[model samples]
Structure formats: C-alpha cells, structure tokens
Target: MAKHCTIIQGGMGVGVSNWKLAQTVSKAGQLGVVSGTALDQILARRLQDGDQGGHMRRALEAFPFPVMAERILKTYFVSGGKPAGTPYKTIPLLAKDNPRELAELCIASNFAEVFLAREGHCNAVGINYLEKIQAALLPCIYGAMLAGVEYILMGAGIPLKIPGVLDLFAEHRRAEYGMHVVGALEGDNTTMHFNPADFTECKLGSLTRPKFLAIVSSNTLATTMVKKASGRVDGLIIEMRTAGGHNAPPRGKLQLTDAGEPIYGERDDIDIAKLRELGIPFWLAGGYGHPEKLREALSLGATGVQVGTAFEFASESGLREDYKRDLLQKVISGTAHVFTDPLASPTGFPFKVAQLEGTYSEPELYAARPRICNLGFLREAYRTSEGDIGYRCPAEPTTVYASKGGNAEDVVGRKCICNGLLANVGFPQVLNGQRVELGIVTAGDDLVSIAQFLPPGQSYYSALDVIAALEKGCSVLST
Candidate 1:
C-alpha cells in the first residue's frame, strides 16, 4: 500500500477487464483492476472453452483451495470446447439463500481472476464490483482477499457497509450484508451472510483488508462515505455522467434531454472545491483520459484519473477484436456515436451505449433478440403482499416482470445488459439454430480520442501507449 499509482484502469464488466488487461496495466506501474462482476460465470464460460492458454488452469492450480478448484474445472472444463455451437452450462442466480456450489464458484472464480492478474507482478491489483449486486458481495470480497487483492473499488450504488465487511473478512470473521429488498416491511429478514472459515481450503491466517474506494458523482456522497461508512474509506473515485457503464442520475428531479439522455445541469456537478476540503485522495473519471486532462486533475488535487475508454480498446483488454477494430475505425473516421440510454439498464441507471450497426445497438438487432433474464445480476428484490421476497428485472420479459410486481413502463427499451456485456468480451451465449450473442458496447465521451494512442500508420494501440500518452502529454505525440 505504498501509493504511487497515478492511473487506475477502470474495471469494465462481464470479463472486459480480464487478467490480461489488468496484468499488463499493473506491469506498467499503474493500478490494474479486474471486474469482479459475474466472475463465476466468466470462469465457468472460460473453462467451458477448454481453458485456453492454460491461464485459467494455472491460476486454479495455485488457488489455496485445490479441491474447490478441481470441482470447478471438472464440472466446466471441456476437452476441446463443447461441440461447435452448444450452449454454455447455466449457473444458478445468487440470492439471500444461494446454492453452496454457486457460492463456491463465486469464491474460486474471484480468486482465480485476481491471482492471474497479480501473477509475476508485485504492483497492486484491484477488483471492481457494483454494490447494486448485493447478494454475492461477502464471498466475492473474501475470495479476492484470499488472493491478496489490494483494492476493492465499488460503485453503481451507495456501498456504506462494504468497508466494514472488508474489515470483518480480514479478521477471518463472519460478515452479513442486508440485501436491499425494495418493499420489505419492518423487521423482515433480508440478510446475506458469509463466513470465511466455512470456505477455507487449508490452514489460513487473517487476510489483509484491501483499500476501499467508493465511486461517487457528488461531493455529498464522497463526504458521506468518509463520515458514515462502516469502516475506513481508503479513497474516492469521482466519476461523471460522461464515463462508461451506468451513470449517476442527475441531482434532484430526473429530467431527460431531447436526445433521451439524462439532463445533467449545474446541480449535478461534483464541486471539486468541496471534494478537496474532504482531505482524502480522489480520482477524477469521465473524460480525463488525455494527458492535459490528467494534468488538470492533478492540479485540482486529484490523485490520478480512473480511465476506462482508453484502456478498454487496448490490445490487452477483453473486448472482442472485431468490436475494438470496428469502434476504433469509427473513432478514426469521427463517426462513433455514444448514446447515454436511460432505459437500457435494469438498475435504472443511465447506460452509455456506442451505436454500432452490427451489434444490439442497432434497432433491428435489438428488436430481434428475445428478452431473457438468465443472468439475473441486475434483478431487483421486493417484498410481495403475501410476505414473500420476490425478484424481478425490467429487462426480463414484460409479462414475467409484471407478474412479479414490476411495472410495464419499467421494461421499455431495457436490454439484456448481462448477456450483452458477456458478448462484448467474446463470451456471448449460443442458443439453438446458431443464434449468437450480440455486443452492446459502452464507452465514455472520449471514445473519439482513443485513436490518439495509435502510432503512425497503426490502427491499434496497447495499454502502455495509453499510459505513455497520459504521462508525457498528448501534445508530444506526432500525428
């Protein structure tokens, strides 16, 4: 925990920020982050694909718990990958009462990801999780901790209790997180619990409590994190609407622009002055990928910039080669269109989507993909009138969502983000008749500038190129 990293590679979801990207970034003297979101599924899918390059197998072999790793590999590893177009084995959804196998996969998969990322590098590796995915939080954290993950970065929701959970797990104690059931009555139980001892594979000692960085868009939330968090607030990641993935809703009343994106006015600003007054390190996200912008943020008292869009297109990133190639070409031609879709994500947060013709961003493609919720990561839990806890996602079939107490209006324009994200990293699902997964790309407003990383006559770039551009200043780069 010697704080020297000035750049943090954002942990893109559904396997986008895989070990390759994080390891490359960390090797270059920066913080490399692996997305902890749905890593169990990612590992399973990778194992199903024959554990290519033996990277997954290597990590699993090093996993402290050999038996657990063996079980996972035995269940999912395919000899030469399932015959051509067969569908991947389905995984159960995480809930207040999760299946033991699902929990074990969560722990093993997270460990494997972090272990691989930290391989051959002493530089700190971090794991990113959305607090909105509450049910699987405890075990994931413990699993990452098992691999000595240095940082736990969480956002997409207020995560006041996570720091405390980190504290508990590091002490080898049990931790409980109350799942936010939308309509739970007073005194009804909705807690998710995890005890480290139950899952330990060998004799173990207390773990190191990783530094916790809570992503926030406002000074209010930053201050609240330090003042009200369950334990130590290591730092803050101040992101803006222009960043990729889900964005914080505009402050106060929600308003939409003519383009159907959130209308972020003055009130939505993070108030850098107030943030400075908080007396802790904070990284500026959004359009801060350029050298000049990074310099400006440091001048304004930021530790560094949490950059996503730039690193996201790097050769090491998990983004499919074709998707990266197409998007980068559009960037070079100045034809890339990024839409901040308000209804695409089931979590009700505005999701930034890069409009690509061949992907789900296209009208016909979106319309043709049958609505399904097999992943269920963004499913919302609510209390039924009959005193039972129920889960529903707006992205699920309109009829099914409505039957579970979800409103019809909530389902409009909602895409299957879970499936679409997996597709972005080349792990898309395959159904009958050769139907394939489609990509739904998300990027920041800085998508156009990613081309700057390219060397003369080259159409692609690497993670080092991005770090170099930011550190040396873009003005130094020759066209």
Candidate 2:
C-alpha cells in the first residue's frame, strides 16, 4: 500500500464519476471521489430503471438502517423499469421545509451512492458536493459519514461552515447550516437543521472526522478558508477557470473576449510560493492532465493533480456511450469544441460547455426546451416583502422569476442544468411524452488531449490507461 498518492480523481457530478469509476481509482491507491451532488435524483432513477443488475439493492443491504433501506426500495424500485417515453416520477424538491420523506430520500440516496463506491476495496473513498447547494447539505453529509467517507471536498462557494458540520455529525449531534438568502436582513432566522437521532434508533459511536479540502481559485480564497473556516482546514484544491463544470469567476470587473469567454488576467494567477507557505497540502486542477503537467505540479509543492477530462472519458465513467463516442471522435478529429458560457449557470459562476450537435449547447435545442424549473437545487432563497423566505431560479420561467424578485437580465442564457446533467448519464427525463431530454456535456479545456489516453487506432480508453499515462515514470504511481 502506498502512503501518499498523486492523483485525486475529479468528482464530476450527476453520476459522471460514479461508483464503478471511484472504486477503480481508490483500489489503486488514489483518492477516488463520487459526485455527492444530486444523488437523490440518481438513486430514484436507478431504482426506477430496475437497478439493472441489483447493484443498488446490494449496497442498500449494507446500510445500517435496514428499515430505512427497505422503505426506500419499496417506494422507488420498479420491476422491469418504466415504459419508454414515460417520464420519471418527480420527488419533492429539497428546501429548508423539506417533507420528512423527501429529506429521508436525500439521506438514503447519498448513503447508497457512497456505500456502493466503498465496496470491493479497503482503500479510502471521498464524496464531493457544492457549497451552494445548502438545503440538502446536513443530511447528505450525515449519510456519507454513515458510510465512513474519508474526505469531503467542496467548491462552488465559500464552504466556511462545512468542517463544523462534519464535527457535529461525528458525535451524532444535531447540525444546522445558515441558508444563503438574497434579501435577508439582520437577525433573520433562515436555517436548515438535521439530526441523526430522528432517523435511526440503533446506538451509534462517534465517526472519524474526514479531512476537509476547500476547492478554491485564488490565494486570497485559500488564505480565507484557512484562517476563517469553522473547524480544522485539512488541505486545498486550487482549480483554475479551465476545469469542467462551474468555475470561479475571475477577480475584478468581469471582462470578456470578443468571442464571449471570461478573460482571466494576472489577478487570476494564484501565487504558488505564497500558497506553499500556508503549509497545507494542495492540488492543481484545470489543464494539468498531462504527464509533464503532473510532474510540474508536484515540483511546485502540490500533493498531486486533480484530473477530470481524462478520467471522465474512461471506461468506468458513467457518461453514456454515445456521448463518449461522439466527444472522443471529435478529440481525435481535432474538432472538439468547448465554450465557457458565462451566463448559462444560475450560480453566476461561468460554466464550461462542450459543443455538441444535439446537446443543450446547440442553440436550437437550447431554445426549443421549455423554461421550467423542476429541480430546484440551484434556486436561491430570498426574503419576500412580508419577511418570509421565497425561492426562485433564474433558469425558471421569466414571469415566475420576476414575480419572485429576480431581474429579467439574469434569466438570459440560463438553462436547467440540474435536469440536463442527469440526462448526460442516460437517465434523461422524457418530457411531453414525445421528446427525450438532451445532454449538456462539460469537460476541461484538456478535452482535446484525452486522445492521448486512447491507442492510435482505438476509439475509447479505460481508467488504468489514464492512470498509467499520467503516472508514467513518476514514482508516485502504484505499480
């Protein structure tokens, strides 16, 4: 067994970096992470799809509360899967006032994902969540802790309160997170709370607090997390704007090129020397997927490099085969196109989008889809005029968003990413009984270089191919 490793497999969301992919990397002595975002939707859809080979049921059997597991199985599992062209049954969206059943689904679904990823190996496994998705944070962390998740890495916002939540959950104590509200005044009591005792009657022991790594973009954010986090700060992952999914906006006035991507300047550069002085282990993400880039990161005082694009196309990754084949062919043909869409994400963070013909990146497909917000994870809470909390998503209908205090300008270019990402992994919702959801694939700028992992004639690659390529001649790679 290796004491220290050099790769932190990127935790791509909505089932892209799933159990099969995580298990492969962890078993090889690296930090394999499953996307903890949207597991509630992933779990229910898996059950409705017949769980295809009983994988979900097998993991649920290991859940500490068999009663809870049985309840979830009974409610969502379909024997032969739903009829084609029929939509998945929607569960209630998560909110501070989530129904007891809805909250349980979040917990059980998160637990099942981590439990399944941790099986068939003794190595450590981690789960990744966005700090912005606060409604389900408490129960989701508790569920992951129940499966002994070894690390919790978060980004997409300042996660100053996460380490403390981990501390409380380890002791089986109740935990609360102050939900971010847009128009709340001082003394506002907007918060979401959870307790393990509410779910299980079995006696429990204190769980080990997993290491916390705050994913950040600048030295300032890194220093802020180190000096201001609620509990111990374990490490950091410095991801640049080139990484897939949501990227931290560049500092200062938001300027864009004539082509429309956000311009990154010297202010965007993180001072490596200053960061190394913090004496905390860090990893470099965004375009650092090559062998030389990996070596360069290690030489710069990093623990390793977090690679997403390479592993995202691996055999074990959860991306549908058609999308993989389509993208890989583009990579090989030198025509793979990725655009950094500044306004597509409702979080106000720039989202990386891979341009594909039928995906949501297409103007036609993006325009044709109705503006409906079924999944509300990205919706923000605001204080209404009556001092009551109200929720709205910029991606939702324009009239509805305006009625809830959202500016009409914010609605432009916004897409329903929650549903779009799930569709990328083969569980796209069937809408209107006549149309199937279109996928919106996200990859790092290194999407073109993924061709290196494949053979000269081969079209696809496996997880080991990427690990071997990055670890070639590097002593940190396991033999």
Candidate 3:
C-alpha cells in the first residue's frame, strides 16, 4: 500500500501553493501540494522578474532537457527584470494544437516547480492540477513526472483518463486526450496529442508513475472513478462546496438562497458509509482546516483532511504581501467574508471570492477593469463554423465573445480569472504601460477562522503552524 499523508495541504490558486510553501510543508513531514494551474505563465513571469534569488535558474539547471531549459531562459529571463512600467511578456495561449514553444514552456515550467519543491527533502511532494485545463494537461503532467513527483491530484472536473495518461508517460509513450469542444460536428477532430519521444533530447529511460487522486464532491462520482477510470485511481479527495477556488455546483436544480448563494441540499452531502465501502483511502476537504474538523474526518473514515484556506494565508504562500496583509487584517478583525460567486468564473462553475473592497470582488472595481483574455487558461473550446476548434472566454470583451457564438448574458458578471489569479501572485499584466490588473482573492468559507493560526501576540503564521494545529486533534485522539 502507498503511504498516505494525514494532512494534505490543499493546492489553492495560481501560485498561492507555490514551491516555497509546498517545500515548507513537505519538509515538515506532511503532504505539500504545489498548485499545477498556470505554471507555464508563473514560470515565465518570475523569470521576467529577474528569476529572483536564482531559484528558477537553479531548478532549470537540474532539468534534464538542457536545450529546452536554455530556450525558456533565453526567451523570458530578463537580466535585472523588465522596466518599472512595462508589461510582462505574454506567452501564446494553449489550444487543441499548441505551438512547440508553448509546449516546451509548459513542460519546463512544471518540471522546475516540482523539482524545487522536492529539494532538500525526501518526503513525498505532490502537484495538484485542475482537470478542466485540458489543453495543457499532457505536457504539464509529463514535466512533473520527469521531476519525480510522488503524487498527482486533480479536481474541478472528472479526470477519468488522467490515470491512463500517467501509465503511458511512464514508458515515454505517445498519449492523446480528447478535448471537450462545444458544438463540434460528428466528423470534427477534438483530440490533443503529446508524444514524449518528440520532445526528449536524449533517452531518459522509464519514469516512475505517480499515484493519482481524483478530487470529487459526490459519492457516486467517487464510485465511478474507482470502477471506471482508465487506470488505477489510488485514492480520492471529497471536497465540499465550501472549499476555496472553483466549487462544484450544488447537486440537483440550481436553487439559491435569499443571499444568492447556491443552496446545497441533502443530495449534496457525502454518504460517509457508502464512501467507506469503496476500499480506497480518502480525504475530506472544505471547512476541514480546524483541529476538531480533522478529528471528525478521521472518525468518519477519512484518511485525512485537505486544508486550503489555512495554508493560503501562511507566511510561505506565494500570495502578494499587500493582498495577504489586507486579508489577514480582515480575518483578525472578524470581518473576513467569502462569497460564492456563481458568475465570476469563465468555466461557469461557482467560484469562492474573498470580499475585499479594492479587488475584483467589489462591483465598482470589477466594472472598472478592461476585459481581456490574453492568458486563456480558462477559455472554453468550441467548434467554429469553419470546422476548426476555436476558444472563447465569457470574461473577454462582450463583442468578442458574441462574435464567437457565445451568449452575451454569459458575459454579464464574468471576471478575467486568468489575469486575476496571476495578479494574486504579484504578476499582474500591465496594459499599454499603464492600467495594472487587479486581483480577485478566493478562499474557503473557513477564511473567517484563519486568525486562529496566528499566535496570540503575533499577527502572522507559517505553514508549519497550520499543519501542527490540525494534527493536534489527531494526536490527542490517538492518546
């Protein structure tokens, strides 16, 4: 049996669960998960910022694909960072068939992240990816495996084929993923392909296939994964709607409470008894950051608990200092509020947003920002009238989305999540050498209680503090 971690740090945002935070937690003897979302952009932006502390460079030096690494460095690594008022260089958006440049960036970036996170530690480190980012999945997973990642966890969509992709990559074989294109004619080709041999400079024999964990919210989905996945699903993470980032919509009809939040009925609740019968290790997420909640999860047959909101505010997280300071202050003042914004995410999934005045959570702030889709991480794939796959994001300009056959109504409250997430990590894109993108912070409903992680006299806390606090309940239960 594979070893299971009692505390799996939830992979929060674009760069929130970065290598620094993951290394800190993993070195402390728990599972530290680096967010696998938008890593290509994260790597490029950090390099443009002078590759601060030479960490990215250090990791790239160890990357087996020297030529690929060199290419990325030459393309994005600015000597002392870009000019004060200049916009960061943007990479091309990924699509059904990505350019070789973008593919190489995706691979090298993911490898660098996992490599650095695993530095100075023999303990297991994991990379978490949103299964919805299908365009980048192939290259990204290949990169993580190259760095010897121990676990791969995915959420935000049903990842039934990911396990099989892992199996193929282990042997350096060709792997293809069927892209979900909306309104594709019967004969349209909607498949994305990646072959390891094509990208490898030299033969690097077989890679160890990492364990796969599918994050799901329903018992039926868990059972389906166990029984029908393309390859072995090592475990599961049952995340409740209260968790941070993009949440699975409530089961049944989309009924909302008076406050406009989705109402989760009995159908949304996980049947722990049925879950136990699946015979796979599982973790419970969403509001499971507290010691008592960890204890409760264990008693109810969970392998452990995955906590995000707590770790998100920890000192090691990659969140920008100003934003972190503002949010932490709110938490301390007992005024931190997280709203489940059903219309914010381009994916149409309900996204949790921390209510901060100056951020995109405010009506005025969100309206003031110009709509752009340069990053394209959250764009949807659709069949164009010309019989080719095209991409569209509702958060883009209203006319742009409508021209691509999208409903203008879908663009009503949609925010540029890709840009907002990048901004959260202090890499907001500047347009026309002016207008800076503002960030939209996402956290679990438990954001109100992160203040508990702060010591009595201190206003800040570390990832270790959060881990130790959650483990306290388990230790006491054992006693």
User: Considering every candidate listed, which one attains the maximal TM-score?
Assistant: 3
Per residue, candidate 2 scores C-alpha lDDT tens digits across 1-479 of 12445899989997999989998998887889999999988999999998998988988888888888888899899989988788998989888778877887888877888888888888888899998999988989999998899889998889999999999999999988999898899998888889889997499888978888899998988999999999988889999888999888888899999989999998889899999999888999999888889888988889889989899999899999999999998988999989999999888889999998889999889899999888888999999999989899999999999999899999999988888899999999887887788899999899988999996678889888888888862655333
| Candidate 3 clash pair list | none
Query: Model 1 segments beyond 4 Å from truth?
Result: 473-479
Q: Model 2: runs farther than 4 Å from truth?
A: 1-4, 476-479
- Give lDDT tens digits, candidate 1, residues 1-479: 44747899999997889988999999999899999999989999999988789888998898898988889888999977877677899999978888889999999889999999999979999999999999888888888999999999999889999999999988889999999998898889988889888878678888888999999988888999989999999899999989988898887788888888889899888889999898889999999999988888888888889999999999999999999999999998999989999889888888999988789888789889888888899999999888878889998889999999899999999999899999899788886648898989999888988899998999889999999889874334322
Q: Note the residue pairs that clash in candidate 1.
A: none
lDDT of 3 at 408: 95
lDDT of 3 at 201: 95
lDDT for each residue of candidate 3 in 1-479, tens digit (9 for 90 to 100): 87799999988769999999999999999999999899999999999999889999999999999999999999999999998779988789989899999999989989999999999989988999998899999999999999999999998888999999999999999999999999987878898999988899998989989999999999989999999999999999999988999889987779887877888888888999999999999999999999999999999988999999999999999998888889999988888899998889999999999998778899898888888889999899998998888899999999999999999999988899889889999999998789898999999999999989998898789999998899897997799
Task: State, as a TM-score between 0 and 1, how close model 2 is to the true structure.
Answer: 0.97
Instruction: Give the Cα lDDT of each candidate.
Output: 0.90, 0.89, 0.92
lDDT comparing candidate 3 with the true structure: 0.92
In model 1, how large is the Cα lDDT of residue 56? 87
Report the alpha-carbon TM-score of model 1 versus the true structure: 0.97
**TM-score for each candidate, following the candidate numbering:** 0.97, 0.97, 0.99
